[model samples]
Target: MPGPDDVSIRNLTQSPVPYKVLAFYKFADLDDCETLRPELAQFCCGRKIRGTFILAPEGINGTVAGTPDAIDALLDYLYGGAFGTRLAGAEAKVSWSETMPFLRMKVRIKPEIVTLRAPEANPARQVGTYVEPEDWNALIGAGDVTLIDTRNDYEAAIGTFEGAIDPQTKNFTEFKDYVATHLDPAKQKKVAMFCTGGIRCEKASSYLLAQGFEEVFHLKGGILKYLEVTPEAESRFNGECFVFDERVAVTHGLAQGEARLCRACRNPMPSTRACGAIG
Candidate 1:
């Protein structure tokens, strides 16, 4: 069997593909997220879409899957602002599967979309420079660069860049403590961080910049985009990338991997950390 890293685009296409899985986020001021929530949920339900969405004053974040036409319709509704607030700059990372990844649809209004808890860490204000997938390897490979993984502890256990530092945070709210205690601005100047998708790192990069970090960079479109675009031969990511869905994980080709959810944590664990080992 070819290893996970050996995945090629050949295996990426699903037979009779019927669902389009979209992962997207945007940091903007949405004064009416409360008003928009119900209508958005109703629209998704009407379109037979399934997944979760977090709408906040800061912006929106979610990963939902539906048929191609349905997905496009949802995008149109969002960008067109049928709910009265347009997400014109929303960027989506798309993939296809044979079935809907989520069992139901949910749209909730929250205080912060991704929840870093620091009011100053506003992605709408500033963020790190974007390092394209093609150029990521060179940037992180440089000795002066400090590569960091902004995801929680379990996500990093499944996969990460070769030299990245895991903050070991069990939840995103703990990230502020990790940054204040573990990082040094004067010593680690050129920082590059990433997450499962772009949301966490989008806010994280903004936080680091607010803390006086000299230079910060983030993976554009996050890991999914990297796996989708970077050929395996040129890819630096190792193991399967955990995803928030029934598929559990995906590999270098953006093809689903052999991961399953741990009932205790309700999070995807690698096959090596199967049910017997999960706690």
Candidate 2:
């Protein structure tokens, strides 16, 4: 969970957890992505913030972890217009961790922040309606809705919403192919999609809308937001949500799950057994 909104109470020394990890993304035009890249890297480096950032012409997407004070400074630097243009409407899913999730920091500019490799999937132009976490169940429960998990196959293997369709694609680029071959807008008119942190779903929803889907809805802030707000008793998530970091996965309430990545195969397993043993 995020630190107190009041900056004065955000002192790192007083917090129970020393590190605050933030998964954030925003879709906006960034004409100066290249120039802002090195500058952003330097700022994060100076603040000791460590995470991978994808800066692109479309927008910014990344996860960073640091002390509360440092994180506050980083957010202030980002939204405070130090980069001339504010990352307007950029919000993050925050959670406390005792350890840093990444080994080092990186800021690289790419063609698209969350690439579906389809120009039509531009969130800057349009995207599906945002469904709040609390209202997600009702939306998906509707008989006319088709919920698709837009995360990669590996991610879906560990956990996903019950009854949601898994496209089983190895990578994001394959999503376009899956849609073209397996899905039809005229048949599944009302579709909903979700991803780890809402970025992929945003792009996917945009693509679906462009493909003539009658209605598209995406989980606002994605699974992380849903887990944060939904209690375990009411949760539709069956297993741990796989994350792209040392944490591997997180459960309801965003707590670190018991599952760990196997040392050999790097697959998530509930036990500490070797890959073969688990397999």
Which residues of candidate 1, in runs, are more than 4 Å off? 1-15, 83-85, 273-279
The alpha-carbon deviation from the true structure for residue 102 of candidate 1, after best TM-score superposition, in angstroms, is 0.8
TM-score of every prediction relative to native: 0.91, 0.91
lDDT tens digits, residue span 221-241, model 1: 899999999999898899889
Instruction: Name the runs in model 2 displaced over 4 angstroms.
Output: 1-15, 272-279
Scored by lDDT, model 2 comes in at 0.83
RMSD values, in order shown: 6.0, 3.3
Candidate with the greatest lDDT versus the true structure: 1
- In the predicted model 2, the residue pairs found to clash are none
